[model samples]
Target: MESPPADTAPQTPALTYRAPTEEDHARVLAVLDRWWDGLGGDDGARQRAGLLPRLFFQHFTDTSVVVERDGHLVAFLIGFLSQSRPEEAYIHFVGVDPALHGHGLGGELYRRFFDTVRAHGRTIVRAITSETNTGSRAFHARMGFTEAEQSFPGYDGPGTTRVTFVRELEP
Candidate 1:
């Protein structure tokens, strides 16, 4: 039997998850606009990219995560224990390669973040998304997060309103 041609050969995905480092700041930022392109068009994507700042990588590396497949970034989650809320952790941002959505990568990243925060005594995890982002809302619901009764206006800016989601971790 002849082996399949290289072009037609099956390729197994090799994914690795690790805490993000300061060096990843630029790389992640570079992809944010593209990663979130679907959420908004070119201009909107650029605006969304501004949501994540270099400070996250600099200050929250210990609590953040990045996933790579065959050495290429496929997903990431930035989270941290809240300084003002001892029992709470906040998920600042999350992104999965658009090509690889719905493959459990996002959930895996969330689970890892939850475990990290849980180990640090955090009992609640919170996240927020634009109310128009139905995909995020559904994903959060499926992840066992409860939504707040109403969206918070100006949560991000003057005209921005966001839906908050919270999940209670088991002790």
Candidate 2:
């Protein structure tokens, strides 16, 4: 394929990624709720805020940082640590505001997440995304994640059924 010329492709804007504060939970929840196509209601967000913190942020840690643009919370990535020894990291969720995508914010978030995990002496970083979420799969791949395993029995638990993608962190 001819490179389509440089002008044919659009340029993306720069973004910043930083830890989310308790104040951010409400906005983050709103973004996540909107992300899942109205699957999350007021009651659901309230309940999730309680249940999720225990599962991922009990120790005062955040999975992924918030992606902001022009002083607005456009998107964010969510992850957590493992219970195993030596301390491993797992990305519980990765998302972006559909309106704010294609600007490399997601890629930067992965790099930031990897750095945080590496700092903690974690050797591996893994996460699961649905098979239907092709965009996510591609984004992970772009961030140097390889397909370590594939589980396609169609299990039901989270947003939807999809294949799992595991990426081992660098040494």
Candidate 3:
């Protein structure tokens, strides 16, 4: 089959980023499991949904972001300045429409988060992922996060170990 002319080929839609509102709770949850399906099976995805409670949308809207393409939800980054550690920020969770993986959407979301936190006086950013998640580990590394020497056992709960990452923001 012959390829379509360059001008006739489909173009990527422009993405819009904005702060998530309380009303977006349902919308994000609706797609959370499906977006995480590749990392975990259906059952795992269902369990993962519980990890992101409604609290992020309710209280962290200022630091959180939702991304869309043509009015459809495509990605999000839920993060916040550390209440206890004034110089630190934590990225609670992030998700990108799996179909758009490798398109730089995730990196762009992270860069936005970094800029926000840096403007807030945060000197460090931290995040975590399951030890089994090689994709996340690699992605974090690519994003300039340094992994801890060892996984933290029971970091999430009994029998759950997690790989922690930290990055120092350039001044």
Q: Order the numbered candidates by lDDT, best leading.
A: 3, 1, 2
TM-score of the candidate numbered 2?
A: 0.70
Task: Name the lDDT of candidate 1.
Answer: 0.87
Cα-based TM-score, every candidate: 0.89, 0.70, 0.89
Please report how far candidate 1 places residue 154 from its true position, in Å: 1.5
Residues 1-171, candidate 3, lDDT per residue (tens digit)? 999999999988788889999888889989876777646576467557877889999899999999999899999999999999999999989999999999888999899999999999999999998888888899999999999744999897776688999999997
Tell me the whole-model lDDT of each prediction, alpha carbons only: 0.87, 0.67, 0.89
> Which residue runs does candidate 2 get wrong by more than 4 Å?
1-16, 36-63, 85-87, 154-160
Error of 1 at 22 (Å): 1.9
Poorest 10 consecutive residues by lDDT, candidate 3:
38-47
lDDT of 1 at 157: 78
| Rank list by TM-score | 3, 1, 2
Per-residue lDDT of model 2, residues 53-114, tens digit only: 53233344555577777678887677766777466688877677877579766777778888
Give me the displacement of residue 101 in model 3, in angstroms: 0.4
Task: Look at candidate 2 and tell me the lDDT of residue 32.
Answer: 66
Stronger candidate by TM-score (1 vs 2): 1
lDDT of 2 at 41: 64
Candidate 2, position 91, lDDT: 80
**Model 1 misplaced stretches (Cα beyond 4 Å):** 1-9
